[model samples]
Target: MPSSGSYAMVLDSTFSTERRACRFSRILIDGGSSINILYRDTMEKLGIKQGQLQPSRTVFHGIVPGLSCSPIGKVKIDVMFGDKNHFHREPIWFEVVDLDSPYHALLGRPALAKFMEVPHYAYLKMKMPGPKGIITIAGDYQKSLTCAAASSQLDESLFIAEEKRLLDRVVAMASKQSDMPTDPKSAETQGSFQAAKETKKIALDQADPKRFAVVGSHLDNR
Candidate 1:
C-alpha cells in the first residue's frame, strides 16, 4: 500500500478556452499504463478548454476480471514533476479514462515511469546532481511552487526528453521484471526515502522563516 500522501499534481494546462491548475489525489502510480489519463470533471474544474486537446491513447482501470467498467476519454494535461531542489516540466496529451474520482486523474506507466529513473539516495533524501532550474517554475516557497520544484527543475524540453528516456527504459525494464528484486528490503528502503523527504522539508522551512504553512485554511479545519 502507498503512504497517505501519494498524489499527482499539475503545474499548468492548455485549454484554448479556459486554463487552470490541475491537481488530484490517489493517482495510481501504475507502470502498466501506456499514457497519462485525466478526468472530465477535473478538466472542467481546472478550466481546461476542450479545443486545446489533441488525440492521444490511454489505458483504463478495471481491466481486472470482476469489476465495474470504467470510462476514459482523450485529454491533455501540463505536468511538472521533480523535487524542490530539481525538477522537470512537460505538456503531454492523454486520454480521460476512468473518470470517477474526487481527485481527478491518474498517472499511469508512461507518467509514473518518468520519476522512477531519478537517482534518489534513500539515506540522504535528495536527488543526485541537484536540481535543473531551467525547467522549474519560479515562485516563493509556496506549497504549489515547492511541489513544482520538487518534481522538476522547470525545463520543459529537458523534462520531456528525460521522461521519454525513462519511459523507454521502463518498457524494457517491465519485460525484465523477473530479473529485478522484490525483496522485503524494498519496504525498508521506501520508509527511509520518505523520512528523508520530510526532513528536507523541515530544513527548507528553517532556512526560510518567512514561509510557514502551505495549506492555511485547511489546517484550521483540522
Candidate 2:
C-alpha cells in the first residue's frame, strides 16, 4: 500500500439491487456526510420517477454555507454490497436530488452506521462484517479519478450550454419587447396642473435633510 498522504483516493464503489439484477457504480462512501444521496439521473436509471418518491420536508446543509438543500423525496430500497460469496444486504433510505453530480450515488454516515462498516480512506477500501465472513471492498483509483474527471468536465460543459441558453432567452425577450407597438403619446400629460400655496420640505430625520417629507400650507400638521 502507498504511504499515508502519498496519494489521495476517493472511495468509489458499486451497489446492486436487492436481487442483484441491476448495479449502480461510482458510489462515493462519504462518512463525513450525514445523509445518503441519490442523484436524479441514477434514480431514473433505477427506473423510478419523482412521482413515486415519498414526500419529505427535511432540509440539509454543508453544500454552500448559508444554503440549505431540500430533497426531492426520500426512498427506501433494498441494496446489496460485495460479491455473491460474501455480501451484506439491507434496506437503505436515500434522499433524491435533481442536481447532477460526479457520482451516481453517495453512501454517507447513515449507510456506514447501518452496515457497521469501517472505511480506510488512504487505502480506498471499506470493510464490513457479512453473514458468511468479513467483506473487504476496494475501489480502483485510476477508474475513480477517470470517472471524476469525465463527470466534472461534462458538468462544466453543461453549465456553459445552459449559460448560452439563458442568454438566448434574454435576447429573445428583448426582441419580443421591441416588436411590441408602443404609442409615444403616453409620455406627455394632457392638462396643466397648479399647486395651492406651497410649503417648504419638513425634515423628519434630524441627521439628513435629504430624507424629508413635503407638507403643503393647505394641509394640517396632523
* Model 1 RMSD, rounded to 1 decimal: 31.2
Task: State model 2's lDDT.
Answer: 0.74
Q: lDDT (CA) for every model shown?
A: 0.45, 0.74
Question: What TM-score against the true fold does each predicted structure earn?
Answer: 0.38, 0.64
Candidate achieving the largest lDDT: 2
Candidate 1, residue 11: Cα displacement in angstroms equals 13
Q: What's the residue-level lDDT of 96 in candidate 1?
A: 58
lDDT of 2 by residue, 1-222 (tens): 545423323453444453334566677777779889888888887777789899988798853333467899988877678877777887889999877676788888899999998988777778999998898888767756776686668667766877799999999999999875576553223324434468767778899978988778777666
Q: Model 2: clashing residue pairs? A: none
Where is the poorest 10-residue window by lDDT in model 2?
Answer: 186-195
